[model samples]
Target: MHPGRLEGRYVAVVGPADDARDVDLARAEAVGRALAEEGAVLLTGGHHGVMRAAARGATAAGGVSIGLLPGSDRAAGSPEHTHLLPTGLGELRNGLLVRAADAVGAVGCSWGTLSEIALARRTGVPLVLLDPWDLPADAGVVAADAPAAVRAVVGLLAGR
Candidate 1:
């Protein structure tokens, strides 16, 4: 990636942190890596589980990973994140996360992920779901895996 391809693009990876399954974590990690490879910046809740895994993957790819924390303390976020923005907005920070994203890759299902998904849909932001909840097709395009999900999101962003 020339970086300019997605210089200002932000892709949010939303999923369960504490309750994330191993499979979800793996998918999230792969998603993060793929996004980074395409020059898209990765965004997450910035705590644990999928968030931490995605941040780690982004870092591994030499990409930027921005963690948006709900706490006032920046140190409360995951260490893997290259940058941390402590919102102190608590759960309300979900809105900020979704709003900041040019697209969203949801690796798995969770209450928080659901909120993010809904926000994306309501705002008409492109959304890609991987091994997530049984959402309606109109809600978003459900991809078979991480790479496919990233592809779908990229296509959507390109207005394809």
Candidate 2:
């Protein structure tokens, strides 16, 4: 990878869209902020809960936030998102999110988040888990805390 490879690199932040705990949302927001500080473009499912929090953080930090909406209505996406792509693919859009990202950061545990993680892993995209699910050691997923999420993701991206 180039020395400045992380700059403008798209990193997807996957987590619960709804019913996420306050702690989880906070962690995701911090991860988003850190990624923005490191010059990463934040990408999410583009709805509520953790996604909203992450987008808010990225935008607040003067960074770009992109959302892949599950529905055709772009207005359904969070206002914090700098750009919204209405895929109209519903949950299946998760695959696109993983494919678009150079690396993925999982903030919280959820069925959708797990699916994203699996997709990233299967596609050989580096994954950084933040207070989330655990796969086998051989899965090559990087485990990190909320504060370390960006660094871990950047390291993975650089390795690639």
The list of candidate 1 runs beyond 4 A from truth reads 1-5
RMSD of 2: 2.6
Clashes of 1: 0
Per-residue lDDT of model 1, residues 1-160, tens digit only: 2553455699999999879999998998888888888888999999999999999888898899999999999989999999999999999999999999999888898999999999999998888888877888799999999888888987888853
Instruction: Give one digit per residue, the lDDT tens place, for model 2 in 21-126.
Output: 8988898888888788778899999999999999988888878899999899999999989999999899999999999999998887899988998898899988
| Global Cα lDDT for candidate 1 | 0.90
Question: Residue 97 in candidate 2 has what lDDT?
Answer: 98
**Highest TM-score, which number?**
1
| Root mean square deviation (Cα) for candidate 1 | 1.4
lDDT at residue 43 of model 2 (Cα atoms): 93
Residue 21 lDDT, candidate 1, scale 0-100: 98
TM-score of candidate 1 against the unseen true structure: 0.95
Model 2 residue runs over 4 Å out of place are 1-5, 140-144
TM-score attained by model 2: 0.92
